[model samples]
Target: MKKIFFARPYRFIFFPLAAAAFLSLISFIVMHLWNYLLPGLLHVDMITFWQAMALFVLCKILFGFGGRGKFGGGAPCMRQKMEERLKHMSPEEQQRFKEQFSNRMCHKSGHWGRRDWFGEEAKQEDKKAD
Candidate 1:
């Protein structure tokens, strides 16, 4: 069983099957409890309840395995990879990178610094305006 789980070909099928079984079991217990508590809350018969439970399980499997592209799917994002690389850098390298990034951004946006917004330069401009 462990070997089957570790096998590449079986893994894809195994994960969704396991997830669906787990979810279905939980759903079944919840539904049973709800039925016991309210009896006829939704007027749901056994057949209809089972159908709804199966549908819920199917949706869980599809969204969990298919939606996120986790099961050997989807192209990975470059920005995420770059951010991971940056995070692994030394503290000195990080500070240098941050300085370069801020300088570039400030140059592009024509901002001197955060304090420059309301400091002596802006105060002088305001006095001249008055």
Candidate 2:
């Protein structure tokens, strides 16, 4: 028993167990608060309150603990395709592509600095265009 508990393979069990315990605790606390609030605010009964709590827990389990593609297959093929595409690009084209991709990513991510949005060169170009 001690050896089994200390094994590396058993370490994986701890993660899901801890996660489930934490999620259950959160669900219980949230349901308790909702029960307290709903009875005073809207005159709900204990049965209805418990039913809502069960539904909430069910939804949480379905959405949170459900199997997602992140843990499944097909990721390797997608990564291989991306690597192959990158390997096929010329050095200059790759540099340009990387610059444009980073710029678009930065802008779309909404973490732009002062110069990131519109710099002196961009302003000059805008003025020239006008």
Candidate 3:
């Protein structure tokens, strides 16, 4: 209808042009930075604009750009789902689940925040106090 014609330019031309311009700006900055810094400091050869664009793509593929996921923030959704599932678990089931999860997970100190991993240790201390 009328909407189709109105949106066609945005779908076809405007978005593509905008993407190209933004990518070009990033590539230009990368190119200038490499040209200015590396050749003088490390004796590495300078790269062209297209080469810089390719490098940007390569780094994105290898290291990822760390954007939000399709469902928005990923870990929050996962944690909420986990908590929901855990709420339905029996006491024995919760113990078994905790054992299974803690055994599989080996986090370094200070890596994760505010989680009680050793309730069994506290229970043992209570037995000693009695």
What digit string (tens of lDDT, one per residue) describes model 3 on residues 27-60?
9999999999999999999999999999988999
Q: Candidate 2: worst 10 consecutive residues by lDDT?
A: 110-119
Runs with alpha carbons beyond 4 Å of true place in candidate 3: 1-8, 70-130
**lDDT score, residue 67, model 2?**
41
Give the TM-score of each candidate.
0.30, 0.36, 0.48
For model 1, the stretches where C-alpha displacement exceeds 4 angstroms are 1-7, 40-49, 52-130
Better of 1 and 2 by lDDT: 2
* Local distance difference test scores for all models: 0.65, 0.66, 0.79
Candidate 1 per-residue C-alpha lDDT over 50-101 given as tens digits, one digit per residue, 9 for 90 to 100: 7657766777678774543423344567657757979999999888666665
Error of 2 at 119 (Å): 27
Off by over 4 Å in 2: 1-7, 47-53, 61-130
* Predicted candidate 2 versus true structure: per-residue lDDT over 1-130, tens digit per residue: 6675666676688899997777667767766876778789989764444465687778877877444453444567887885788899999967866675557544454333323444345678889999
For model 2 the TM-score comes to: 0.36
Output the better candidate (1/3) by lDDT: 3
Q: Name the lDDT of candidate 2.
A: 0.66
Ranking of models by TM-score: 3, 2, 1
